[model samples]
Target chain A: MAKAHVYITYKNGVLDPQGEAVKDALSSLGFQGVGDVRVGKYIEIEVEKSAPDEIRGEVEKMCQELLANPVIEDFRVEIPNGNNNPQPPKSEA
Target chain B: MAKAHVYITYKNGVLDPQGEAVKDALSSLGFQGVGDVRVGKYIEIEVEKSAPDEIRGEVEKMCQELLANPVIEDFRVEIPNGNNNPQPPKSEA
Candidate 1:
């Protein structure tokens, strides 16, 4: 199987209200010395096949068609190791 | 200089309403084959120093202070190369 890691973030020069809200909330909770908060989105998808070209097409389609709001958000997709077979690291637990 | 990358997502076993909303939005936009959609937050911070222990402490403080919602979101902090000098890959453009 192949995995696609997608990151969606607000375009540069745009103000992020959600990030500001979170920052305010944090300050109220007594966390000081923190500044400049920016928030973005991350998604991971697993596909049954491992072809880079095909996966790239699918991921681009996915991002354009549904994953991102192209108007305000820019997205980046990563395919680890050229193989499309990416897995989350195992935990010792 | 040092950098901190923080990722925040809904806690396991929690329902991700935003993901569901996005999935529905995608379907309405005519995208098929996307079965699941989960949304999370990603943040990168640039700090003035590169000391590992001090940077770790600062990052934890930042996450606990304003970057994530401890009530509903779980977070992970990554210190790239143990030096806090992580940078985005350069683009050929």
Candidate 2:
């Protein structure tokens, strides 16, 4: 089994109104000096009995076709342990 | 500047129909053996000149107050270097 993690965000040039609203909310709530707040979607897929590369390809297709809006959004996929763990260990060896 | 990565997903036991729909869509598209497809949100907040721990606290409050729904959704925050670098190095040094 392989798990694919997908992150979908607006293209850099695209304006994200939702993110702007959230920023305003934060400022109002007394979070000082917040710079930019951008929101996106994160999706996880568990593909059974498929190679990591195959799962990656399938998920990328899904992202292009439905998971993200190509006109304004950009998406990325990562297969955990295939290089995406972003968190530190509980204890160093 | 500090960048914070936030991942928000449905709490365990919560129904994720969007994820289910996507799973069915994948099946229709002929990708076989896809299992447990789940969807969530990814948010990035850029805060200027703050300590890692302080940024963590602010983001957590933001998550609770507006970013994520405390009822059905759960959220987590990661300060890039505070311990999340899941990707392997480009070259073994």
Candidate 3:
């Protein structure tokens, strides 16, 4: 099985009210030295077994088609290599 | 300045309806081999200048107080050491 982790964040110029609210709430909660805060989405996907490169391509297409809104958000995908590492073949005596 | 990145995810065994919806949508859209999907929150915070360790502690408190719900969500904090790397002072010639 191949898995992908996708991170979606707002564009730099966009106003993030949710982040703003969290910052205000933190200030009110007496947490000092808190500065700018921004919020975004994190998604983990598990897919049928395939090559990591192939899975990445498929996930990228998925992101473009439905996962991310290109107008105001940018997405990055991380495909971990641990599960995809090929096992060493057993040596014949 | 120290920066923190927090990832909030659903605890294992929690039903993620949003993830299910996304999976269904992907199936309908002709994307094959998609499996389990999970969604969560990603938060970025910039804080007043401080040591990375101190900033991590402070951000932990913030998460407990307002950012994540402990009942069903688990949060992990990562404080990058990039911005905090020290620069050597130039000696007077």
Candidate 4:
């Protein structure tokens, strides 16, 4: 098993209404330090018997083909520990 | 400046409509291996000057206050390098 973490965000110059709304709400809630809030998507996948690189490649294809609108969104992928184990300790040490 | 990465996903037991849509789309795109898809939110914040722990605390408060609906969403925060720098190399080496 392998774990893939994916992030999808609006392309540069695109207006994110959901982010704006969250920013407004934050300000109202006394989080005065927050300036701009951009909201996107995060997805975690558990794949069976795939290498990290192969899983990442497949996930990128997934993002481009269906998960995100490549025309208006940018996406990123992270494979924790360079392996399929997702239950590893959070600390490197 | 410090960078903050926040991820918000639907709480356990909550139905994710967007996730369902993405799953359907992926199946149509020939990604037949994907079983279930759960879509959530990813937020990146650039703060002026704040310690990692302090920034994480603020971000948690922000998540609880407005960024995520605690009633239906759960969140996680990642501080890339335990510091404010986000331009570090991808590999620790």
Candidate 5:
């Protein structure tokens, strides 16, 4: 199994109203130092029984085809070696 | 100046329907090896002339108060040393 962590963010020139809203909210909340705020997406994908490189490629394709808006966003996919396998559910207690 | 990168993700027990939808879309597109998919938010906040620790603290408050739903999401904040400063706008030419 392999896990791909994808991050998608608006390109520099794109207007991000949500981010702006958050920034304004923060200022109203008294964080006067706050400046630029950009909001984006993070996705975790697990691929069963696949090579790390293969999982990386698939994630990139997914981001391009469905996960990100190519016209306004940029995406990055990260696959950690050896730690790529999905972990067994951890016990809470 | 400081920059805080905040990642907000669904808590373990929360249902992520959007993630499931993405998984189904991938399967339909023929990526059988794909398994669990989880989606979240990534936010970047720039704070002017603030200590790194102060920025981190402010981001946590921002996440709890506005950027994330405390009942269903968990957030993490990262403030990289030196890179904490907001980048100067770059010229295309």
Candidate 6:
């Protein structure tokens, strides 16, 4: 199996009201130094294994057609270690 | 400045109707081999630079207090390079 992590975010010129609200809320809550806070979609997909390039092509098509709004959003797909289960975040010191 | 990427996803066992709907849609769209699909939040925060550890502590608090729902979601904070702008995804072969 393979897993793809797709991050869909607003295009640079797009205004994100939700992100602005979150930033303002953070400032009110007294979290100083917070600059810009932008929210986006993170999608995790698992599929039967295929050639890495084939999987990438399938995911790119998925994003273009259904996963992202092409006019206002941009998506990046990362397929980590193509044949393994998703890994947990590494523990920090 | 420093940037943080926070990924928030439903805890194990929580039903993700949106994810399920996306999976069904993918199937209907004739995308074969697509298995489990989970949709989550991807948040990007830019802040004035600080010590790495201090920044991590602040981010953890942000997640606990505002960014994520403690009861239903788990978040992972990634501090990439600590003091640079967000990087574009690397080009694939």
Chain B TM-score for candidate 2: 0.86
Q: After TM-score superposition, what is the CA distance of residue A72 in candidate 1 from its true location, in Å?
A: 3.4
- Across B1-93, the per-residue lDDT of candidate 1 in tens digits comes to 566667777776779988788767767876556566678878766555567777777777766655667777777777777854544322111
Candidate 4 residues B1-93, lDDT tens each? Answer: 677888777776889888787777777877757766678778987655468888877887777766677777777777878854434212111
TM-score of chain A of each: 0.77, 0.83, 0.83, 0.82, 0.82, 0.83
What is candidate 3's DockQ?
A: 0.62
Q: Tell me which of candidates 1 and 3 scores higher on TM-score.
A: 3
lDDT of 1 at B20: 84
Candidate 5 residue lDDT tens string, B12-81: 8789999999999988888777888999998989988567767766677777777888778888777866
Q: Give per-residue CA lDDT, model 2, range A6-91, as digits (tens).
A: 98888777899999999999899888889999999899888874676777777777776767887778778888778554532111
Task: lDDT for model 4, please.
Answer: 0.72
Any runs in candidate 6 off by more than 4 Å, and if so which?
A82-93, B83-93
Q: Which residue pairs overlap in candidate 6's backbone?
A: none
Better of 1 and 5 by DockQ: 5
**Candidate 6 lDDT by residue in tens digits, B4-69:** 888888887889999999999999999988999999999999877667667767877888888888
DockQ of 4: 0.43
DockQ of each: 0.29, 0.63, 0.62, 0.43, 0.62, 0.64
Model 2, B1-93: lDDT tens digits are: 899999988877899999999999988888788898889989999988568888777788788877888888878888987755442211111
CAPRI tier for the interface of model 5: medium
When summed lDDT is taken over every stretch of 10 residues in candidate 5 chain A, the lowest stretch is A84-93
Q: For residues A19-79, write the lDDT of model 1, one tens digit per residue.
A: 7876677668765555666678887665555688777667767787777788777777778
TM-score of chain B of 5: 0.82
Candidate 5 stretches greater than 4 Å from native = A81-93, B82-93
- Residues A1-93 of candidate 4: C-alpha lDDT, one tens digit per residue: 677788778877899998788777777887766766788878976666377778877887777666778778877778887754433212111
Q: Between which residue pairs do clashes occur in model 1?
A: A2-A84
